[model samples]
Target: MAKTFASTGDTAEKTITFAEIGEGLYAFTAEGDPNTGVIVGDDSVMVIDAQATPVMARKVIERVRTVTDKPIRYVVLSHYHAVRVLGASAYGADEILASEATRSLIVERGKEDWESELGRFPRLFQAAESVPGLTWPTMTFPTRMTVWLGKRRVDLIHLGRGHTAGDTVAWVPDSRVMFSGDLVEYHSACYCGDAHFADWPKTLDTLAAYNPRALVPGRGDALDSPKMVADGIALTRDFLTTLYDSVSESAARGLTLKQAFDRSREVMDPKFSKFAIYEHCQPFNVARAYDEARGLDHPRIWTAERDREMWEALQG
Candidate 1:
């Protein structure tokens, strides 16, 4: 039998957890769903990645209210993923910030991504109609920007491209806690549909240089220790390397995409198959890796139609 298309079959709801990694920084995470980071500065709060929809984002808001009633002042888009940015409206944040590259992507393919992702993972978009439209960043920075809530300083840095052409990480200088958006996933599979495979590891290296005391990853449980932080980064690096190495080797040998996919499974399954969204991500991951290995520097835009076509071609 053919496998389910993307995460459409993943209808079960996951329990949410809100854990404090730093003094005022929190991680709002579901079982292995997309995670959101919260930074409570002295005056207001800044959210890392919004949930999939307004309804989904409210869950994060509810958790935020439990600890502090300070208004959510800023909403940060880690990259241009529908599941991460569509919930911006719910925050009612004064500013929606993203990298310039991310804003360009939104202008380029945000509408198509919204449609494609809604089809791929229906569960995440709890109230699809609630989305106002393609989320637009109210503010954008080319490389790095800083915001201060009272005296607490939060630096938003576009370290390098990894998960997407534009990926930004929020760093709390005071607590040494880093909110690494999809750049580093804990136990969950890194969705490489728009990933920069070769650049990803170098970005990871830049992130490691900070030696964050505690880190909140894009998914899975929050890493509250330096050891766990290192481990998470290492695990992400290993996953990317193993997949790219196997798929690239196949591409180098002139294997077909299907042949490359099968070969990748044989190599990646033993270690990463058990990860959340591992199956959901493999086809796209294999396709992108194959392309990059064969010299595609930029990722192709994924549309609802292309999503189905790719799934049918690979999963069938």
Candidate 2:
């Protein structure tokens, strides 16, 4: 298999792959691109995180058609990222769902996020021209909600914020399977443009409580077995912890952003260099961590221009 990531000039945007992680849950991952998940139950199918556009989502729908003919009843937005939720139209579900906070973020900065993400990673969008607009959830919940896949019992919850303010998960209680958005990753890079470093670990703890037997991560290969699932959760937490600590230490020492970025890489590289998206994720990771170290609660919006500016500053 190809490595999870590579920097092949601007043309390299990573590749997408559909993998079956559990009996009925699937992980659709790209080589460091945004990831999506699917849950098939007795009555209907629920897709987590529509790709960037209807054309792109059709690709996923094609994959779904191979296995089942059940109608897609729900499209779940794990968060409000442009690359993740914009393709919801293709599902044509009556009720799209998300955390109430996610709905608020969509109302607040959804357009900006669309522009920002579209600018940053164009390849993942597949059919950029086909994007209808920012996707909005029809139904919103405060924290947790449960849906029976005709009695399969999939729980959707916003336990805590890790990747974004409205991150959600699709968990099967009986099967002990979970589709963690960007909250947990196996090897693919974790995007942190709007991450909450301090609060993410506690949220992770809540996820770990279940000790899932299988997990389809936000990106990377599917993890099977309780050991692999636990490993995924632990590695993700470690990444957040290490990134935050290094950036916090740099701020405490009063380093400049560029200086802090370098410091963060120096601190995290030896152990994480082989991990997916290490290079690509480092710059944005440092920016968010630096803000949090200074006591910023929620992450600020990331503009396309800002992404380029920051990438140039750190990557140079």
Candidate 3:
């Protein structure tokens, strides 16, 4: 292969930052790694987007202990991705929650995704053996569900699909804070291996309608103000549109997937090359864009074998 496969070369540990974006709401971010959200209520706590491994999740739990003694009663999944859901067991929460669509995706591709991501990002899965099989949600809702942590109201809503087919956001109406899984990234590359390019922007629109005062994105630093939130959303939209448009144009011209990848680089590199995981995400992003442009409604499952095959075909 011409380049390292995915993030296998990235082995250095990142500085973990647990920032309070709202009143009693925290965002556990590790540079450009996947982020986790904490919502502390009058009674119990709710955690959003568990990390990739049980050991990694303990890092979040450690931070959660510093603030309040409230037990983490619920763990909410933003999507069905292995990197986001496999750490659920570490929380030991009373209930694990997810959108119905997310649960369905897990049932269909959970095992494959776990294997594929472990191969792609070895550093994220610090203790692979510790992941006790696929993480399943004990509770699920179709579109929206509300949970109360004492007086705090958390609305888990499926705005639409962007990062994946089953993306959900946890909204705190009292504080106007939202925990957006991978739907809105800040100065970080959006991983679109299972993305719906055409449907992503509309989902962003629905998320924007809420006008969150503070937002904890799926990756990068947390947005602590409305301006930052707006910028984050716009940046994500721009990234998606630029990628899809370039790939769609290439497809329209009957270009091969490799050719389309080169075309996409020419357009995206100048604008987003400096972003976190930009290179790691580009091949998969372009492949999905190409598939979507050519009328594939659902994303193809990515197994460990398929991951290497696609990487070699494109990145080689």
In order, what is each prediction's RMSD in angstroms?
0.6, 3.4, 0.7
Q: Report how far residue 164 has shifted in candidate 1, in Å.
A: 0.3
Model 1 scores a TM of 0.99
Candidate 1 global lDDT: 0.95
Give Cα-based local distance difference scores for all models.
0.95, 0.83, 0.95
Encode model 3's per-residue lDDT on 1-316: one tens digit a residue. Answer: 2898999999999999999988899999999999999999999999999999999999999999999999999999999999999999998899999999999999999999999999999999998899998999999999999999999999999999889989999999999999999999999999999999889999999999999999999999999999999999999999999999999999999999999999999999999999999999999999999999999989999999998999999988
Error of 1 at 145 (Å): 0.4
Query: Cα deviation in Å at residue 155, candidate 2?
Result: 0.9
Question: What lDDT does candidate 2 reach at residue 28?
Answer: 78
Reference-based TM-score of each model:
0.99, 0.93, 0.99
Worst 10 residues of 3 by lDDT: 1-10
Candidate 3, 179: how far from true, in Å?
A: 0.3
lDDT of 1 by residue, 72-172 (tens): 99999999999999999999999999999999999999999999999999999998999999899999999999999889999999999999999999999
Clashing pairs in 1: none
